[model samples]
Target: MTPYQRWTLRTDATSYTVRLSADGPWAELDAWGPHGVETGPSALDWSHRTHFFTPADAAPAEYLPYGLRPFTGADLVASRPGEERGVWWEFAGAEEDEGALRLAFTDEVLGLRTVLCYRTVPGTDVILRWTEFTSSRELRLERLDSAAVTVPVTGPARLTYLTGQWSQEFQHTRLDLSRGTFSMGSTQGAPGHAYAPWLAVQDGENGPAYGVALEWPGNWHLTAQAEPGGFVRVRAGRVPHEGAVYLTPGETLTTPRLACAFSAEGLDGLSRVWHRYERHLSGERLRRPRKVLYNSWEATAFDVDAAGQLELAKTAADIGAELFVVDDGWFTGRADDTGGLGDWYPDPAAFPDGFGRFVDDVRALGLDFGLWIEPEAVSPGSELYAEHPDWVYRIEDRPARLVRNQLLLDLGRTDVQDFVIGTLDRLLTEYDISYLKWDMNRPPTERSRPGAGPADRLDLDAQHVAGYLHVLDHLRSAHPHVTVEGCAGGGARVDHATLARTDVLWPSDNTAPLDRLAIQYGFLHAHAPHVMSSWVTDAPGVFDPRSRSLAFRFVNAMCGVLGIGADLRHWDADQRAEAARWIARYKDVRDVVHLGEARLLGSPRDVTCGVQYDGADGRTVVAALSTGPLDGAPLVPGRPARLRLRGLDAAATYRDADSGAAYSGAHLLHYGLPFAWSAAHDAELVVLTRE
Candidate 1:
């Protein structure tokens, strides 16, 4: 391991070495596959090799620059009191933990102490990076960035990121990395749907691909700048939206964790590495087999009541739904999005006998019960809001701005935090609720507290997230049996911080099968499939007008945690029977589909796109969808060709679950399976078991 240098970090497949330069300190990356970390003598030292004409100590114009240097392109940016020039950090030394490396630096002039942290796990190729800042005297920092790493670029390079808006999340976009700064972030109080806090740069058409993802749930920023040399400096951290954090003497501020992953095998390889790291943290694939759930949101939005929910539960149970969730309109005065947010109590008129009988009825139908709750928001007309006027986020003199006719509950306050936890605790304790759909319908607005200015409100943003997580942690600890699904009006609050506490995530409010192909595709690139909860909702979709067959919808939703949000009562006998069969098939192969390695077969934007799931055992499942004209016309000239399966045992004999035809895995992989579906938006699911 390169003799275990004091200022070096190594993952299973990569090595990052740092050194003190005349201008500051910089890091160079070398990555290899499973063979091991590459620490050969030929490794280039970019710090002092003089990539530019300027001397390293003479105000670095090239070479590699860091927070410790006098450079404009610094990875870390900060300002302290009484500093005429920009603050420069000096390397003090380094320290090593069990699986982490820490490099310490200090700016004596500003009485600021900085430490950069890098960590790695055994099976992952990701290097986790973050920065810690401490001050001896009180100071205000304009900006504090997490650790930054310089990646070598060769030939042409491209930067790929995900972007979307409400109802349309996780749309992957790629742009070539240019000379200037390329950046994307969330200025909204929370991580907005416009962009996910992640970025990737692929250097050369065939060289290694490196990526970084911020683990913060609040507003975050990431920037990539191409330097004079063939290197790109990337930095990411929490965004200082209000500017200037007033740091107390003994109070230390740590930036959000920024994780970097490297793969010599390109974007797919890097994506898989990230997937493994996420799975390692979430236990996503190893957790109890995900249930076939039915959420009654699209079915009965604001009309949730006892008799209707009971009928829906019966229909859902008949179709093999293991969990029945009643979404929205369950609480007092909650007829729509405008009212009854903070009041967690059941509506006396809607549920005349309370939720006890409904819960029992659902449980009797052989399905687990779940309730949807939005703990972080309150309507202005809610009784809770009327009672606790100071609980919501509000400016001192300005009137509160309401989104969806609801104001954000200030979890930053201890009392507000207690109320949220207490209400959830009471629900779990009273009812037989196995799942809780924790939701945040709107982003925070008018976030300033009564006495705190805008700068101080920045602290509220961070604290609210912490408080949100604190409540989740307490819930998980107390109700160990209940599983939580995190939602922000569907997918806005998806990040490491939220994923760590929740069991599943709603990728988007838009569940149209055709659109979901692209949405789920982008989502699975970072998050594991098991943690993604996709539903087959009623269409004529809310977002798109493309009418898809139920079979196509089933396969799309089955790719993740299979769910149904369609109104079962409106379905005909044949449709219900077909749904029952599909649900049965999903349950039969869910082990492979939920816990196995996922492989995307084709681009979602193309005429044909599909996914392959390979289990540790000898089972494999392939779900393919045709987006082009399939009925009478061919997308191409002739009929579609066969689809070759992936990650199968080539020598083993396999049997098709439907046809019961036996074939060699080698033949299946070589000759490929026949593509039967020809109708537009038609999907096919094939399950193969080794014999």
Candidate 2:
């Protein structure tokens, strides 16, 4: 009798156990949840067998290839030119070191070695999982997923994911899964606004939540299937180019890390697990306080001039902006989106006094200078494109498709990567630029490399991702002083890989107060607030037309890294004064807001919704908002809307910073902090300090 082998990986608050069945070579999930789950009966016990299905197919597999998981979805699908499209592998060995573990399997006939790797993030309940494949023979990998997670669910699986379009990005969507499969992915070169590379699952409405997030920045997919044997499995990884990727002999292909998290406290608690892991990814960089920025896009647009920008810089400085960013139109030939994209040089006409002089002048106003650039795109009429027409993605005979009035450069090529690095290095070296807002306005429409071989074409996506990361890595190492803000139209390129490289992320282009509130509500669920770069703009409400005051806008943006895109030059004296006050207030509580334990109080759907941050010093800051009108009626007559705060010390007494009012923590937790809603005041910033 072959004894079943078991291994358990433990994090700060969670545990994941994997077992190799005596009946087969495959690994099955024994338990995944709170720390003590492994001590209980196995979640994947053999009792729940399915008819007409192989034991390997019905079992909660940790990771399996096509031959083993024949009936179910496979994590890896590979084949040689004339060989069978399945793997019949046997367990080679397993290695454990510190908090990392690796299980190896090999197919002797194919000379392929597959390693499943797992590493527990220190100080976080997150287990990072990925697979590495090395083969002696060349093969085509149709599907290579990073990790497949088998979540134990008692009832129907409830799924929650993020999905939206350009300006409407980060909308939280939910679905229940009793059976069948649900899939979401991005074929675009980026992690598209259509769907984020993240998913959260639960057993039922009240069960513990499990989450999986892929770290890939390029095209990726996440699929969840509720099997007939009463179990849910999720597979996530980078989406291969076209439908397959080529693996050369002796070359190893490592999939992106998939972060798997569990929280017995629910989805909101699961969010904190993600947040802590992100902060861990930030390392020492998280200590640097994100600046309050002022962008001149809405004010100047393409009509940029030195004097006008200098004037705006002075106003921005007066309003307490630490950074002044010249967004778009600062570069040569960039009068509109149609041209000047590939031209990285500053426009001589717009900056008649010289670009360096303009940057110096902005710095003279006591504000750090920042510039926006889309390095991966090109305009047909631009000099760079004309000089090297073969640089963009296109087949030899097919016409290059245009998106956002521009073409995407084939970043997979080394020459293109060098150009991007050189262009950015020149800009940062020449000027005293402290920030770079890296924007990708469009996805690759015709993603193909001319004259490339079939194998090369299949490797395009992976190479492009590597090249993109290379440029970002160069910026980090070559110029560490510069703060990189990641943007893709609006949150299109957001993922752990991008977030690990960038200092901040622009959530959306739509800054309309109510619309932004909903976006932030969803954004905070999967991402930490410290990385969310939200802006306050004067744009009219697109999703919700109900007008909100400037205070509301400031409070909404203050939920993350606050930036002002509204034209300060057009503001009246009172508005400027109010803006200055809000800016000052944000600065006072910024540390707590950025580093504190964040909790979503009431949801955006509620009449009174807010974000609460509890600081280490026992100071709590709440950005409360009134989502709907209070003119007609109230839910309960003679009662104001209240937000019951969480994570409060029940016996502590707290005092408001501004109102000078005091209340008990027990009272606030049970009855909540009350809000008197009115048309004039639809939002309020409450700062409470424990006494």
Candidate 3:
């Protein structure tokens, strides 16, 4: 803990002033921007960075393109004709209610009281909650620095270059109204479209914005607006898209709203976040991924035929996978998607003696055991539904629309909460489950209850908010060592909110690494690599059929979760051997891939992009991407080959990461690497460890 910094939030003409205590742990966090903030002053920053914007800042013509359009001092004054509206300003509203500082602000749109409290938890955390609310839509954020409460916005979403002789970084960040959503953070994208909001940080290896863009704080509750059924529209970066969202008038959007605690740990996360982002943007391949894990969803879906999934798990373990996860379909009578939700009990028919036996088998194979669950949802046919028909969320008497034949259980209700927590508790107690895959398949809008009043008391818009946090808190406490992941209908709800709660975030269901190349690029720009979900991907619709280059498939999933979703059962000896080698590579550098800084060398949408990773051993994983014409074969020449990097140590040894080729020079060079490729192919994973 450093010393001396009292931050006072105030209003300014264009942006806000976040003055840090002169004699503090950090120098100062002063930034003059139109969006959230950025970490670097280089194009490489785009590798691991994202931008933010709100509806308030969108229409302001002066702040066109809301999120990241590069700003000049002259443009600071409100250049648009309209008085920027919406929840435009936020700051420390009240003194600590207990040990916590209580902050208050209005959502502007719904005129709802959005109060938040932050204070150290005696010896542990700095707790924050959005309570004492008139509207059920209270906001809660986590991972805030218990000590500091202010910082400045700079980098990406703001000015491309510093101006007005200003060079203050956010020592502590407080919100202010600007051209877009916040007073100063005009980091907005298309208003009425579905998008996920992202926050980016930088690390080394990945250039500039190539640090940590960690999304999914924990469990998030998100909504777009105050009106019912309005989709939330939050975008990250220069139009690269990640997650599904939209905006409308009726719904109120409530995000995870996590308070980033800037400790030494945060710096590492920040670095990894940017690195992952850069990798995706550059369309680089990974020599290794964070978790040497495998997912069973692709191999078996909800139809978890014991032998089928078991074989997949066996292959994953044999390929040096550290964790084996049976995604979906393990619960009692839940053999398929049509049934078995809400029934937390393990299915004896599926696992015979429950997961305990499977766990023993996987452990014997030197792999950890993991389970999949969607505790927040209940199947209409499940026993829990039969017993507690009133617990599912609904608008009282309105008819329910079932997704995957299930209904959402309201965490706001204690009984529902108890049921979920207890079920999870029983599972942990009964089995040696080390991981949990928390999935929410439906986007809740129309709130309902079996027998509640007509008045809207259920935080309908905040369902995701309250629902997710409740689960996170329980899992964190009851199963302290277990790793939890947030997966919402693939990658729809991936944002900073859920990042705080879980260890990782499953980016999306689209496993085609090429598509994932774009998806991961967009996701990394705003979230952390530790949690990005992907697999030894396959094309979208094709099943049991024509195989694309397995190497290309390997390259695609290498950067993310780095597991195989393709039916390995169908793979013969040669293909299996190749898959094993890829997994072996991932096992070698998985730590660096998951934790090191990432740099996006080029645009994923372009004909070329490359991802590079740096390690202590001078290890680097460079994934080069070429969209059409060239397959990800190696070294295609004639295409522009000069590579610009971000977040590098700048003075490290170098070599041909793949071919053992040598480079004779200083690690830092203004001209970057030579312009050449092995051959113009689709993708290639180039690994170079400095000897």
Candidate No. with top TM-score: 2
**What's the true lDDT of residue 302 in model 1?**
89
Candidate 2 lDDT over residue span 1-691, tens digit each: 2447888999999999888875567778889988888997787786745588787788788889988778889899888856889988999989988788898999888778999999999899999999999999998888899999988777789999999998899898999999999999998888998898989999898789999999998989999999877889999999877788777899998999999999998988998888888888777889999999999999999888898988999998998999999999988898888999989999888888889998998998999999999999999999999999999988777887788899999888999999999999999999999999999998887777867776444577888899999999999899999999999998899999999999999888989988899899999999999999988888998988779888899999999999999888889999999999999999999999989999998787888899999999889999999887755233666577888999898999999999999999999999999887777778899999999
Per-candidate TM-scores read 0.93, 0.98, 0.65
Q: What is the C-alpha lDDT of each candidate?
A: 0.77, 0.89, 0.49
| Cα lDDT of model 3 by residue, 51-111, tens digit | 3532222211111111122221111111111333123222324454435444444444433
Worst ten in a row by lDDT for model 1: 56-65
| lDDT of predicted model 3 | 0.49
The list of candidate 2 runs beyond 4 A from truth reads: 455-457, 636-638
Candidate 2 pairs with clashing backbones: none
For residues 316-432, could you state the per-residue lDDT of candidate 1 as single tens digits?
998889999999999889888889998898887888887798799889999999999999989999899899989988777888888888899888788998999899999999999
What is the C-alpha RMSD, rounded to one decimal, of candidate 3? Answer: 12.4
Clashes per candidate, residues 3 or more apart or on different chains: 1, 0, 130
Full candidate order by TM-score, most accurate first: 2, 1, 3
lDDT of 2: 0.89
